[model samples]
Target chain A: MTTDLTDSILYLDAVSVSFDGFKALNDLSFVVGRGELRAIIGPNGAGKTTMMDVVTGKTRPDKGAVVFDGSVDLTTQDESAIASLGIGRKFQKPTVFDYQTVEDNLLLAVEGPRTAFSSLFGWRSKVTAYQIYEALSIIRLGDLKYRLAGSLSHGQKQWLEIGMLLAQNPKLLLVDEPVAGMTDAETEETARLLTSIAGEHAVVVVEHDMSFVRALDCKVTCLHEGTVLAEGTIDSVSANDRVIDVYLGR
Target chain B: MIKFLFHRFDKTAAYFIAALAVLGVLIPILNLALPEASTFHIPTYLVSLWGKYLAYALLALALDLVWGYCGILSLGHGAFFALGGYAMGMYLMRQIGSRGVYADPILPDFMVFLNWKELPITWYFFDHFVYAIAMVILVPSLLALIFGWFAFRSRVTGVYLSIITQSLTYALLLAFFRNDMGFGGNNGLTDFKDILGFSIQAPTTRAILFSITALMLALGFIVARAMVASRFGQVLASIRDAESRTRFLGYRVENYKLMVFVVSAAMAGIAGALYVPQVGIINPSEFAPANSIEAVIWVAVGGRGTLIGAAIGAVLVNFAKTWLTGTFPDFWLYGLGALFIGVTLFLPKGIIGTLTARFNSGGKGDTA
Candidate 1:
């Protein structure tokens, strides 16, 4: 119930979600402390992505509650509200603005309070720009900022999407399979980038790459059938009985 | 932030855009001033006609907000336009005062002709230009809000959403066609009357209407341009391309759609209100589904997402309509159809949209 950090950022207690008749998440209790890096690994349909969905306000948990910033009840909030509250999510597939420049795509992720009624005057600011470039540096796409996001390579596209998440300045980031489709070098670099950002923000990376997970070298939690099966260091979780049977055992 | 702002401005082609806007205003003025004696007296009505065209341009601009950016192709824009026109028409009817054939003193000519007892409840505010103008914008926006909230929250999109919009407009057309509606019914609202105590038929009045139309279009252009340039605009584009992904990226895609849709409708309403006095009539024809469909053509012809391009398309197509109807009457519809197909196929981005493609381009085809 209590997150161990200077400021408890995200906490989900007994969160469960059902789609149609099937339970995507069941009695899941977890807390991501401020600046903590946690890797979530599970087999296909272990509800890893579903869990992220609930946390991001994409999917409302049928039961239990998700609390952020110690007091903000996430269950009643929507996705944009959650994001505006400083939580970002990167999907498995990169979704950058294709027609926009790499820099523009990253810049678009920068948050501002522009509403439909008042936006007729247009939004103009300089602070958001600096944050965009700073994020591009972290993902190492600063040089190709002028190139179209559509023209970027697959790895670069993935990196650009990650950089976009960074621009949002989320206190908590839920990244799904950052290395899902990348070369060994790209995957290694992604692990390093996520690791580096972990010091400033809580990161829940759902990655299948065991080596990349080991590279993260953070607490690992294994989920089976919508519930956490094991949790600990990679060496400890990898050796757990059920964790070996459902996932990573292969 | 300067770099970011500049980058988006450039992406939106805000540089040469000022020049195009100047051309948009000047060309009409020059055309109107040119001495000519044609069968249609084209120059005499050119300003007012073009003013209405500019209003249509604003409608196209509004369409771009939802369809071009947010990926919602509403087929009910005409309904919103007509409702605003109806509100303005009420004001015009009120302005009629005792100037009617019967000189009933209190009622509009139609109401006197219809043998109504007194003015309807909603007719109370038409006497106040300010309230009427405010309703011109507010009414459509509220309708859009209610409709969008239900449709989007229920997850209706694509062709289904388009169908719903068409149905919405069709329903409005039917309702407005009724005499008991207190609108003009089948005859609609039209007469020789004053707008603000000045004879609407005067040359000076026409010039003023044209100027107002131009200013409104310019305002629409600036606002629409700024919106598509902002962070919210980016979220809207993201929603257009991939709603589910945007949701995962921590955006309530429907709320964004609802917000922009309502704003766009209000813009269309303003366009329709300006259109009434210029065109000299506000009929139920304004609510026709075909009118809304033609709006889509205007947007597609100019460029769907490009706000200025939509404006360009509205003006150009209407200009062509005037000429084509004069020259070949029956063939205008065929020509209009051909034009739509040609734009969708050959230019894809419409004229201005294609010309700017070399600078700011997307994937190979239309996102629609």
Candidate 2:
């Protein structure tokens, strides 16, 4: 059960998970408020992705509570059920149905009747059309709507996956390394796209690129081991002695 | 319903149906109406053989519905096919009434030979044609429902799922071979006298059955095409490509798999039901894992994801088998192996797929 946490859209208190005797997330507590865009930065094994996994219901925490929208307990649900509750996750690698068209990828990801019969009958609605249109423009792939997703370039595929998340209409979006291998221009466009989306949705981004984090210009949380090591403005977190010692090679 | 059926209709499917319809009508006319001495006349034996191929094409189409579209490779589809045949065989045995060598009016010849005094309780409703048809559909679908529920619920997929499906058919094969199981023991059910009071061996009856088989194949193709053209089909393709991603996008993957699997099983059952009468036998040999694998090969040779391709592959491969076995019996298996290898190497997309790629659209991008 979730305790009333009005200030935060998501509340994770003392969440921990382990795999094969190795603790991936240990005593980690975090929160994201409604319509707030937050950035999480960490080294390779600092439990950044594991936290996303826990929030998205892909991996169950060994102990603790994950409350979403103030009261909905995310850990109690499975991946699809959790998604139905308006929580979306973008994987580190851009994963779309490669054989399908870009428009079809968004249409399949649209928030609607997820059951077999409803989808089989007719899942297309006005709302879905509007969302697909919006997503195509957002991802800047309007002309490529009919193109197979597999044929898209690497950066384009990344944008298409983001478009898929937008079509989902999620309340809280967990984006992992969204600009890992993008061109400089593509990264800049992605930053603008994500920034524009912030005021309407709670977006939590995890990345290793310091420039990208600075471009986001949001409150930053730097993780070390399995807990928050520093939390503040980008400059302040980067200036922290422990962060400089453990993450940024001095 | 009409709109939905026509919605997915394309040139390939249209041509497929046109070909089947021509064959359906012309085969009966050639075999029944024309004199046997005429060059245009087709012999009754060839008509029955082609009918068997049509039934097999239906089976391959059913397999393609799941394996090709949904990516659920079932290596035991023959089990469903065999179960359907057994249901039809039971009804045919009942039609024998009082014609057995032992002169028993109630029991079939095998039961009479075994000195059984009464029919088994499992055979209760099979005496009626309607009930037998229902069983032909229900029995396979029921088995698929139960099996798919447990396997998909637990997320057993890929090669593991294929292996289990093979094991399922093998287990059924072993069970049906036993004499005490009441399915005529190792001999299985055969020597059916009539169906709906029509003589089983009559040319007119055979023609009707052949026409029915062709019609069923066309219907199955249409249904499969409509499904793949729907939103549900998109979701299924997404599941096949990236299952975990589809789940994260909010689809109950197991339910979709279960629904398609059950539909596929019912189609296979119907194929089997038609097969028994045309081939004049139903036996445990139908449950062989090799037969199921052969069905997979047919789909692969036609085009794994293309419904029309699968049907064509089934007929083409079976025709080759019949020809090779008769003309060069010793080289049949080796030729079959080479065909599979050649398809894997040069025709990876299959006969129809490669042709479509070359003639229709050049790019990999599918038209909306």
The whole-model lDDT of each prediction reads 0.82, 0.91
Per-residue lDDT tens digits for candidate 1, residues B80-167, read 8888888888888888888888887778888888889888998887799999999999999999999999999988999999999999
lDDT of 2 at A174: 90
lDDT score of residue B200 within candidate 1 = 89
lDDT of 1 by residue, A108-191 (tens): 677665354433334534545678778888888888888778888888888888888887778888898888779999999998
lDDT (Cα, tens digit) per residue for candidate 2, span B1-368? 68866886778789989999999999999999999899999988898999999999999999999999999999999999999999999999999888867778888889878888889998997989999999999999999999999999999999999999999999999999988899988899998889999999999999999999999999998888888888888888998999989999989999999999999999999999999998999989999999999999999999999998999999999999999999999999898899999999999999988988887566654543
TM-score of each: 0.86, 0.97
**Per-residue error at B253 for model 2, in Å?**
1.0
In Å, residue B97's CA in model 1 sits off its true spot by 3.2
In model 2, what are the clashing residue pairs, if there are any?
none
Docking quality of model 2: it rates as medium
Q: What's model 2's lDDT at B248?
A: 94
